[model samples]
Target: MDTRNKKRLGAMLLTGIVSLSAIASGCGNNAADDANAGANEQPANAATENAVAGAGMKDGKYDPPITITYLRPWGPDVKFKDGENQDNNVHAKWASEKLGIELKNQWISPSTNNAFETKLRLSLATNEPMPDIISYRGDFNLVRELIDSGRFVDAGELFDKYASETWKKAMDEDPSVWYPYMQDGKRIGIPILDYAYNGDPVMWIREDWMKKLGLSAPKTLDDLEKVMDAFANQDPDGNGKKDTYGLAIGFKNWINTWMSDAGWIFGAFGTMSNQWNLSADGKLEYGSVTPGAKQALATLQDWMGKGYLPTEAGLYDETKAAEDFTAGKAGIVVGPHWMPAWPLEDVKKNNKDAQYKAYPVPSGPNGQAGRHGTSNANGVVLINKDMAHPEAFFTYQNYLFDQFANPPIGGEFEYGLAEGYDWVMVDGKPTTDAAHTGGFAPEKYTITFDGARIPGLNMATLAKLADGGEAATPFEKKLKLSTPQTMLDAAKIVLEQKDITMQQLFTGAPTATMQMNNDILAKMEKDTFSQIIYGKAPIDSFDAFVEKWKASGGDQITREVNEWYQSVSGGQ
Candidate 1:
C-alpha cells in the first residue's frame, strides 16, 4: 500500500480524521538557496556523461562528493533522535559516508495539513528551480503537474542504464506500475514499490465461534449463509443474547476500502464496485454499474433483512465497522492478511479465548470468487532533468533495493536500519521491541518513506513459509520471526486465489469528465446501492440508476478512461 493510505489508516486507528485532502496554498521561497545549485556548477551535458560513465561512483564512492537536494513532506508520525532532524539524520549520515552523496533537504513541509503539496505546487507555479530529486507521495495530479512542468528527465532511460538488475526485475514484475508516471512515451518517474497483494481481501472469521457452533469452513455462498445464520442466532459468545451479527461491513465510504471491506461480496458476483474493470470487449467500464452489482446488492438486502448486520452499518466507516468484530459483536469480517496484527488482535484483548483465522473468500452461487487486488506502486521518485548527477538517486535507491530491502543473512542491515533504533542488542540477541529500542523508525528518515521493497517478495515469502518451506533467506527469516502464523496462512490463501483478484485496469490520473462530475456520479452510486441494500429502493431501481449515470457523465468518463488506458498501454 502507498504511504498516503498507510498514514490515513494510522490516523484512523488513532481516532484522527479518516480522510484528508491536499489543499493548495501559497508557500515561501525557502528553497531558493539550494535549488539548482549543483546544476550551475557544471555543464549539463558533461555532468550527464560523467554520471553515466561513472555510474555516479568511482570505486564505490563519488570521487568528489556530490550533493543531491530534495523537498520532503514531514508528518507527525516521523520522529527523530534527540539531536537529529530530517536533514541531519542517520540515513543522511550513512549516505554521505558510504555513497559519498551529500543528501540535503531543500525544504521541509508538514504533510498532515497539505503544506508539502502546497509548497510543491507553488514551486511549479512560480517556475522555481527544481530540487535534484522529488519523492512525492501525495496526489497524482501533483505528480502529473510535476511531469507536465517539463523539468524532470525520462527516468526510464536512467533506470534502464543504471538500476541494479534486482531492482529492474522488481519493477518488471508489474509494468503497469509506470502507467501513472508516463508522459509522451517517456517514463517521467520511478515508482516507489511495496509488497503486492498487501491490500487484497481475505475472509477473517472467529475460529472460536466456528468451533463453538460446530460449523465447517464456508466454501460457497450457501455455506457462508448457514454459518452467518449460526453466528447470528446461536450463542457463539455464550452470552445468550441476540446482540451479535453475522458479518461486519461498512459502506459509508465505498464498498471497496482498505479496512472492513465489502468488495469481495461484489467480487463473488463477478464485479467490484467503485473501480474500473476490463470488460470482455477490452474496454474499461464502471464496476458499480455492472449487472453483477445488482445481484450483490440483492444479497446484501437479504442479509440486512435477516438481521445479519449492524443496524447502523450504512453509517459506519472502515474503522467503525471493524469495531463490531473487535468488540465481539460480529463473527466474520473481510480484510487483508494484516488484520490479525491490528483490529483482530483487539478481539483477543476483549475476550482472551477469541481465536480468529483467515479463510478463502466463499464462492458465489455460480462458483465465482474474486476480490480487489492491490497496486504494486505506491508513490514515485522524479528527478530534475538539469541535475548534475541523475544517477546518484538511482545509485542510492539501488543500494536500498539490493541490500537493505531484503538483507542477506549476516549483512549490515540483517537486523534493522541501525542498532538501538529499529533493533537493539538485548541479552545477546537482537530484538525489535519498542521498549528496548525507543521505537525509533529510521526507515521513515530515508528519501523514500519506507525505503525499497520488492512488490512480490513479501507474500511470496509468507506463502513459501506456509507451505513448509525453510526460512532460507534473510527476508524469509525476518517474516518467520515477526509475522504471525495466521497471517502466513492467510498469505497462502491470498496466493492460491491470485488468479481471481481483479485489479483496477485504469491507473492514470482522472479524466476530464471524472474531474468534473465524479463526485456526483459517486454519490449517485453510493446512495442507490445503500438504498437498495437497506430496502429503501427496489432492486429494479439499479437499472434506472445505471442509465441515468451513463447519461449524466459515466459514459463519457468510460470512453476517456479507455482512451487514457490505450495511451499508456500502447493499445494493448
Candidate 2:
C-alpha cells in the first residue's frame, strides 16, 4: 500500500495576538525623578524580565503554551476513539502536556472531489488569514500558488536551526527533495519524507509458465524477445486457446505510470517517455522527443504486430492492464517490489499453480539498463510568515523522527501506537491483529500525517536481510517477520541495479509555457506514441512529431525548465 496521501494530518487553531501599550500619566515629575525610579526598579524587575525573555522556549517546552494552527484535507479513513477527535486526540494531548504546545485546526474540508483544494483557492482569493501551518499533498500548481501568494516563510533558515541531526541526515540523502518547494533561491516549504525506492520498477514473471516453456530468465533485450515469443506462441498455459500475450502494459494515460508500467521498455533504449532527463550537455531534455524513443516505439510496434500485447492495450489504464496479468492472461508485468502482496497475490486464488518471481530488468543492445526512480518526499509543509513559534513545529517533528520513525528497542512505539488501539497483549506478547487490538490505528492521529520516516532506512534494512544479515534491530525484526521472502529478494535486486534508475530531473513547478500548453502537448505526445505502437502511423512519423513538439512551445518549456533547474542547483 503506497498510502502516501492517506498519511496526512489536518486541523487548524487560532492564536490570540495581544498588543501592550504604556500610558503616560502627567504627574509633573522631573527627568531626574523618573531616572531614579527606573534605576531603583531595575534590580527588582531583573528576575521577571529574564522569565519574560525566555518565555518562547524553556527546556524544550514553551513557558507560555503556544497554539499552532494548520489546515489540512480530511477523509473517512481518519478515525477517532470514543472521546478523541482530530483536535483533541492522543497526539494533540501529548503536544500540550509534554511540549506545552497546542495543536489546533483552522478548518478542514473533505479530501474527496477536490473540496479541500477548492476551499483553499477560495481562501487565497479572498485574502483570508493564513494558518500557522499548511500541509498539502495535492496539485503542484496549487503549491506554486501558495508560494506565489507570499504568505509562507522561507523555511531554509529555520530548518537549519531547529531540525534535528537525524532529520537533517535523512533529508540530505536526497537534496532534490527541496526542488519542488523552492522559490527565489529559498525553500518555501518543508518536505514531508517517505521511504526511498518504494516505487522503482522490477520485472515480475510467471515462474510456472517460464519453467513449463523451458525458458531461462531474460538478461538482455534479445533474450526478452525470445521469452515473449515463447510466452505468446508456445502453449505455456497448455489450455490450447492461443490467447495469452507476452507482456502486460498500459498506455491509455501514461506509459510511465505506477502499475503495468512501460517505462522500462523505453528505458532499455536510453530514454523514458513523458519525463525530463539530464542531457550530456548539462541541460534538461524532454524524453519523448529524444532519438532513443523512436527506437522504443518501433520495438513496441513490432511487439504489437506479433500479438505480444493485449489488443485493447491502448484503452487499458494502469489498473485495467494489471487485471490482465492477475487474471492469468499475461505472463509478465513490471511494477514495484510490493506487487507480490497485491494484484499478483490474486493470481494464486485464481489458479493454485500460478507462481510469479521478480527479476532484474533486461539490458539493451549496448548493455545499458534503466527504470524509473521513486521520489522520497511526497508532500510539503508550509510555514506561515506571521507564525510566532516556528521552532515549535520542528520540535514536534524532531521527536517523531528520533523516537517513532524507527523506534528504539522497548521504546514507547516499538510495538505500535496505543497498546489497545494498534496493538494488544496476546498471551503476554504484542500483536497487531485488528481482532485483538480493536482495529484502531492511533498513529494516524499524528500531525505530520503518517509520522516521520527516514527515506533510506526501509530499503537499507531489506537489503541487509537480503544479504543474509541477522535481523538484530527492532525495525529489522519487524520487517523480517512481516515481509515475504520474495519481496526481500526483489528489494535486493532493486538495490543492486540502483545505478540504472533514472529519476525525473525537473522537479520544480510547471513553467509558464507548461502551464499554458502542457495539456495540448501531453495529449499530442500520447496520441502519437499510441498510434505508432498500434501501427496506425509509420515509424518516421516520430521524427515529424519531434519537430512539431519543439515548435509547439516545447523549446520554450525546455529553456524555462533548465533555467529553473539552474536556479535551484546554482548551476552545479
Candidate 3:
C-alpha cells in the first residue's frame, strides 16, 4: 500500500516543472568538448579498416581499446558499488578489460516522467555533439526528428555487415521489428529486442479459492461468470465476511492496461478495447466503438451490478487495484505472465495459505481467447553517422549477447553480474540474497546493449524444469533454483497462445490528428465506456461515441495510421 502511494506521489512530483536551462547548464560546453575529442581521433571507418588489417581484429578482444560515447537514462533502480558509477560499473569494467571497449557516458538523465526526453530536446536544440550511440526509449517523434536531422547512421547495411549469426537469428524471429525504425528505405536504428509476446495477458486466479468453491478453470464466458460469482458471493477467502471481490481491475487510464486489465474480456469477444482493428472489408476501425465492444461493456455492467468487480475499480490505478489481490480481497486478476514475481506473490505474504495459478483467460461466446500483442522491440539504438566504427558497437553488443546473454551451461555469468554485487555463495551455491547485495540492481548490468536482452530469451531452464524436465544448463539450474513454478507455467501458457496474439497494424508515432485531439478522444472514450460499464449511460451510447469519434479527429487518425501501415508494410 505504502509503495504504491509513494510511486504515485513520486510520479506527480517528478512530472512537476523543472528548469530546462538549469538542467542543460550541467552539460556545459559538451559540444565543444566532443569536437575537440574527435579532432585528435582517427576517422572511425579508416580506424576500423586499419585495425582489421594491421592488428587483425580479435574474435575475443580488440588489439587497441576503442571508446564509445553514449547517453543513458539513469534511475535509482540501478545500484552501484562503492567504487562504481554508470561509466565504471562491473559491466563497464568488464567491457574495458575483456572486450577492449571503454563506455563513456555523454550524460545520464533521470528515467522518469519526461526527464530524458526533455534532456534530449535540449541537447538537440543546443546542437550538442551527438555521441557514438544514443538510446531513446520514449517518443518515436524524437527518433524521427533524430533521423531527419541526419546525424544518425542508416544501420541496415552496417547491421548486415556486423551483426553475428546468433544475434541475426534472434532478430529473424520478427521481421517487423525493424518497421518502426525504418525511414526512406534505411534502417536508422537497431531495434532493442525483448521477449516475444511480452504483453500477452492471462487469467491469474487463486487456486485454493477455486478448490474451496468446487470450481474448475474457466473455459468459456459462462464458466468465467460462474467463477466470478462464486468468488464474489460465496466468500472464497473463508473469512466469513463479504469483503471480497471477484476480479481486480483498474480503469484510471482505461479498462485496457498492461496489468490488472479488463481488455482481454473485450478481446475474448474478438476485439480489443482501445485499439484499431481491420474489419472484414479490409478497413481500419476503432474496436472500442464496435457492437461487440458494447456486448463486453454490458457484461462488465452486469458484473459490476452483481458485485463481481471492485466497486472502486474505476478510480484505482493498476497497481492500486493490484492491492486488492495482494491483500487477499480479490481472488481473480488478469495480467501478464510476470504476475508471480509481484502482486500474486504478495498475496502469499498477506495470506500464508494463498495458492495462485495462471490460466488462459476464458474464451468468449465467439469461441476465441485473445490478448493484445506487444511490440517486438521496445526502442531503438541509434548511432552517430560521424562515428566511423558502427561495427564496433555491433562487435561489443554481439559479444555481450553471445557471452552473457546465451552463455554455455557453465559460463561466466552463470550466477550473476559480479561475485558479491548480484550473488553470493550460499551453501556452495550462488544465491541473490538481499543481505549480500544490499539491494538488487539487475538494471545496472544491462546499461550496455541499451537495457535489452537477446530476443525471445527468458527462463528457458526454469520453464523446462517446471515441466519436470532436466536442467541442461548452468543458467537453467540457477533459474530453477530461483523462479516459482507458477511463473514458468504462465510463460508456457503465453507461448502456447502466441498464434492468437494481436498487435496494432500501425506501430509508428502518433499521427498529427492524434497529437492534437488524442487526449480529447481518449477522455471521451474512457468516460463513455466507464459510464456504460457503471450503468450511468445507455448501451446505445456506443453508437453516439462512434459518431463523435469519427467527427472529432479519429477518422483522420485512422487514415494517417493506415497510410503509415501501408508505407511500412509496402501496402501489402
Candidate 4:
C-alpha cells in the first residue's frame, strides 16, 4: 500500500518523503555541457562513416557513448542469484551489447502491492536528474502526474520513426493500448500488452470425485447444488472422512481477495466486477446491487447455511484459500489458468492421485453464467527529449517487445531476464515446469503472474487459451499436465461464452467518489455478504446494505462510471 493507505493500518514509520522541483524542458541544461559535447566529437572518426553507412544509417557511425537510466520494480525473488553481480542481469547485458545502451541501476523495491508506486512517487519528487527512459509499471495516477510535469518528451514521433516493423505490427494489433497513456493528445509512453483474456476466471474441480460420484458436469445453479452436495457429503476425498468442503473462497486485503477471488461465484450467480449484462437492458450494466447480485448473495446464504462452504472463508487470505483447495479439504475453486503453476498446484503434492480439472462455472438461474475480469494494457516506458539519435530507444524497445516479449517464432529472447533466475534449461530446453524454475523471486518465480514461460497465443486464440486445456506448445504442455483437464475445459467454456459477459469499460483512474467510498463500500459489501452467508445477518440486510451503498457515494460513482462508459462508446 502507499503512504495514504499505510497511514490507516499504520505499518511502519516511513523514512521520509522527497520533493522535486521543475526544471527547464530538456535534460540537465548546462552551458559548459555544449562545450564538452563539441570537444568530445573528435571529428566523428571519419573512417567510421563507411562502416555506419553500410549498416543502413545516414552516417557510418554515431559518436560518443550516451547512457540511459532505466527503472523496473522487482522483489526478493530477483535478488541476483547464482553468484551473479548485483549490477548486471540478463536484460542489462542484452541492452548494452545489442543496443549500445548502458542502463544504470535505479533501485529495486519489494514490488509489493503499492511499493512500486511509493518508490516511483519519491523518485519523481527528487530533482536529481531523471532517467532518460523509465519502464514504469506502477500506477496510472503516477503516469498522469509524470505527463503533466512535461519533463519527458512526447513519444508519438519517436514511435513512428524508430519502432521496428514487428513492434509496430503488435501495437497496430491493439489500438486501445494507447488510451491510458494519452494526455490531451500527446502519447507519453508505450502501452504494455498482456493476454487479452487475462481477466477470464475458470471453475476448477476435482474430476475424480465427479467420476466416482457418477455426477455429470454442473450446468445450472440447481446442478451446482447437487455437485456441491456431493462434494461436501459424498466423501470426495475418500480418506474415509467427512472433513471435506464443497469449495474454497477467501476474503482478504490482498489483490484478488474475496471480491477478487470469489468474483466467479458471484459471476456464476451473477455479480462480478462493475460490469454485467442486465436482463432488463440489452446494454451492459454494473452488477453491484442489481437483481443478479441479490441472487448471487442468496446462493451464498444457501451454501453457508448448508455448511458447503467454509465457515471461516470470510477470514481467508488468498494464500490460505488456495491452501484449502490444495489440501484436498475443498473439492472445487475458481482461478486463472496458471493456477496449476503456483497457488493451486500444491494439490499434486498434497494428494498425488487427486484429479483436478477446470470447468465453466455452473450456469445461472436464467442461463446467464459468466465470469468477470479486467484486461491489462498499461505498464511504464521511458521517454527522452531532444535526442540527437531519437531512434535508439524505440528500436531497442521494439526488439525487446517483439523478439523478446512476444516472439513471433520460438527463439531465445534477449529479455529472457535470466534462465536459471526465473526459468531453467532442463535437458537443454525452455520448460515452464516449476521444478526447473530455480531461484525465482520468493513471491513470484513460481507464479504465472510474473515472468514465467507461457505459450504462444493470438487474439483469436485468447478465448480458447483462457478456457485452458492441452498446452498450446511444448512449454504449455508441462503446465497442462500439472493442471487438470477440467480447469482447461472450464476456461474454454467461460471464454466461449463471452457473449453473456461484459468487462467493465472504465479502466482508468479511480473516480473521486471511488476514492472516497471505495474502501468503505467494499468493506460494507464483504462484511454484510459474509454475515448473511454465515447466518450472522438476516437476508434483508442485503437490501438495507444496497440502500446504504447508493446513499453513500455509490450513486455518484455509478453516474461517473456510466459517463465514462458512454464516452468510451462514443456516446452510442
State which candidate has the highest lDDT. 1
What are the models' TM-scores?
0.91, 0.89, 0.87, 0.75
Q: What's the CA RMSD for each of the models?
A: 8.5, 13.4, 9.6, 11.3
Question: Predictions ranked by lDDT, top down?
Answer: 1, 2, 3, 4
lDDT tens digits, residues 487-520, model 2? 7778777777888888888888778998799888
Reference-based lDDT, residue 460, model 3: 36
Which whole-number lDDT from 0 to 100 does residue 239 have in model 3?
78
lDDT tens string, model 4, 1-572? 32122221111111000000000011111211321232223232232333233333343222344455556655433445565433465555655665565656556555677786787778778855556666655455677777767777778666766555544544554455565566556677766544444435567788888899999888777887898899899888777888988878865442233111566556665556434333344344557677667777777888878878887787786558778888888888876544554456678898788777766666776666666543434255657564444455554454444443333324453213456654567787765454666534321221111331111132223223334433343223333334344434444554455454445455545668988888898888767777777778887888998899899998888777666545444444
CA lDDT scores, all candidates in order: 0.78, 0.76, 0.69, 0.54
For model 3, residues 1-572, the per-residue Cα lDDT tens digits are 12222322322222121100000000112322322232223122333333344443565566688788888677545667787877778777887887677888888878788688788889898998989998755566777788778898888878777676556666776778888788877788888765455556778998999999899899888998899899888988877999988899988866767678888888788887777776776766777877778889989999999999998989998888888998999888887766676657788788898899988878888797777766556667888988956667876776655545545545566666567766788788777666765664543555443333544545233344556766545444555665667777886677666666766656566788988998899889989988988989988888899899899998899889888777777765
Q: Write the per-residue lDDT of candidate 1 for residues 26-145, one digit (tens) a residue.
A: 011111111112112222223323455645466556768889999767778778898999888888999889878899988888887677988888888898899999997767678888
Candidate 2 global lDDT: 0.76
